[model samples]
Target: MPATPSTILVVEDDDIVRMLIVDVLQELGFSVLEADGSARAIELLEDTNQRIDLLMTDVGLPGMDGRALAQKARELRQSLPILFASGYADTVEVEEGMAIIGKPFSIDQLRDKVKSMLGI
Candidate 1:
């Protein structure tokens, strides 16, 4: 194992879902940060001391949705990899160095997606 595990920031509005995702990532041996919305996510993102290897977020947030949050996150940390979890709505468009995972993903799928995004 590497000296330090990669860290991921996960943003989702649902508390249960967020816990489930964080649990899986922890089982996979990654350090994770959780935020229920963009406001908290921005706080974590803006803290330069935090080491975030990837961002995985739900696209449909209450305010300051995931896409906008991602834009802001990019402004704070250039080249940070981002993954969006959407229900596959037609409106969600992924940009370069970013990816999207459909909602209700299996644990294996989530694991694969995160690892693929992190290039592990």
Candidate 2:
């Protein structure tokens, strides 16, 4: 059987980077949702109609930051998977089981991480 399409929430403050990641995922045939910041990303994840298979967010964000957002999201949905991406990923501490993709990533890196997280 073919795999189901997974709705992925991408939270990034940088428009270019966000678009790049979205383009890569879309090219790989995955469903995508975007949010410029943590608050908006939370809104998408909390939407009853949306079933987010995974969340891919930048580590540095204005106001709520990605770590806090991921923590809060974990509280709301324990089964949700999260991946953090940043140029300064080493500076940010994250939980176990959560993956981190460094900035300046290749399309292959992003695709592989998403696939691993989604267990594809």
Candidate 3:
């Protein structure tokens, strides 16, 4: 039997990048929820009906960067898995058990990283 699609929250300020990631997630059989910034992402989380299984956010954003957003999201959803993607290696540091995917990643890399994070 096939596995169920995981619900993912993608926080990205760039429209192109956000769309690309959303498309990729959809193609990989995951239900994607998008937000342009930290505020919107937080709002989505606060919605009573929504439940995000994972968070994939870009480290560099306009206002609240991925770190701050992840921190806030963690407060709300303590056990949610996070995958921080960044162009710069030093920009997004992985926490105790979290992981980081460097930007310009290929489809395979993204899939592998996500599967590993999700333990699929």
TM-score ranking from best candidate downward: 1, 2, 3
lDDT of 2: 0.88
lDDT of 3 by residue, 30-97 (tens): 88999999999999988868978889898887889899888988888888898898999666558864
Task: Kindly provide the TM-score of model 2 when superposed on the true structure, using C-alpha atoms.
Answer: 0.93
Candidate 1 deviant stretches above 4 angstroms:
89-91
Q: Specify the poorest-scoring 10-residue window by lDDT in model 3.
A: 89-98
* Alpha-carbon local distance difference test for all models: 0.93, 0.88, 0.87
Per-residue CA lDDT of model 1 for 63-101, tens digit only, reads 899999999999999999999999874568899989999
TM-score of each: 0.95, 0.93, 0.92
Which candidate number would show the highest lDDT if scored against the true structure?
Answer: 1
Model 3: CA > 4 A from native = 1-3
Q: On residues 29-98, what C-alpha lDDT tens digit does candidate 2 reach at each position?
A: 9999999998899888788788888999888899998899999889878978999998986776667758
- Candidate 2 at 28: error in angstroms? 0.4
Error of 1 at 7 (Å): 0.5
